[model samples]
Target: AQSVTQPDIHITVSEGASLELRCNYSYGATPYLFWYVQSPGQGLQLLLKYFSGDTLVQGIKGFEAEFKRSQSSFNLRKPSVHWSDAAEYFCAVGAFNQAGTALIFGKGTTLSVSS
Candidate 1:
């Protein structure tokens, strides 16, 4: 079985401060990991993903994540936080094998930006 864990259920950060959202996963084989952000009443948008290649992958919206295979973690980071960055972040994992293509998502972490 595969799963994603977001230790922080909610996070509040002052504007301009750096941000780090934690995520951990458990999978039998190499995993396809992704981070998605969804604003209030909006569709989820992909923040970043790791299939293969460099462990550190840059994503949209000034975000990046590093995939650590040994630790089974893929944590998202942003150098600076903005008001618009407030949203629900989800960490997901996918499989491309015969089992089927479906993403298993974490409960999600809500980010609050303070002025």
Candidate 2:
């Protein structure tokens, strides 16, 4: 079965520090990869995605992700972190065969920005 895993359950980064949230997926074929962020009591917001074409995909809020087929990973990165960027980050995988089915999400990584 296809699944996503976030190695870090929680990360604490100082304000303006670099951030990297790891995401790894297990699937027979290359599946759709997505990064989502959710604030407290808020809905999930799309950060970036890797469908095809480019191995490195840019996303909203100074975020970018690189798709490494060899690693089966689509890791999200940001050069500088912000306090507002603190949220629960989710790595998700969607199958091409199952169009209507919901994506498989990782447990989630909670980001805490420290001053």
Candidate 3:
């Protein structure tokens, strides 16, 4: 089955520290991967996505991810984190079927930034 996995359920980082959120996926073929961020009481916002071509993809808010087919990973990274970056991060895989495309989301990782 095609699914997304976020190993860390929660993570705490000091302000201005580098951050990396791990994400892994299992799919039959090259699948669409996406990272989304959801702030408290806010809807999900797209961070980045990987379709094809370049392995390294840049995203909004100074974020980026590298797609590694061998490792089946698409990890999100930021050189420096801000207090406002603390939010619930979700890794999702897009699955296509006769019913159309649907996103399978991981449990999510909660990021806490400390001063």
**Number of the top lDDT candidate:** 1
Count residue pairs with overlapping backbones in model 3.
0
Flag clash pairs in model 3. Answer: none
Local distance difference test, each candidate: 0.97, 0.95, 0.96
Collision count of model 1: 0
Put down candidate 1 lDDT per residue, 47-88, tens digits, no spaces.
999999999999999999999999999999999999999999
| Regions of model 2 farther than 4 Å from truth | none
Error of 3 at 110 (Å): 0.2
Candidate 3 lDDT at 96 equals 63
Better of 1 and 2 by lDDT: 1
Q: How does residue 3 of candidate 2 score in lDDT?
A: 92
What digit string (tens of lDDT, one per residue) describes model 2 on residues 1-115? 9999999999999999999999999999878999999999999999998999989999999999999999999999999999999999999999977559789999999999999
List clash counts for every candidate, in order: 0, 0, 0
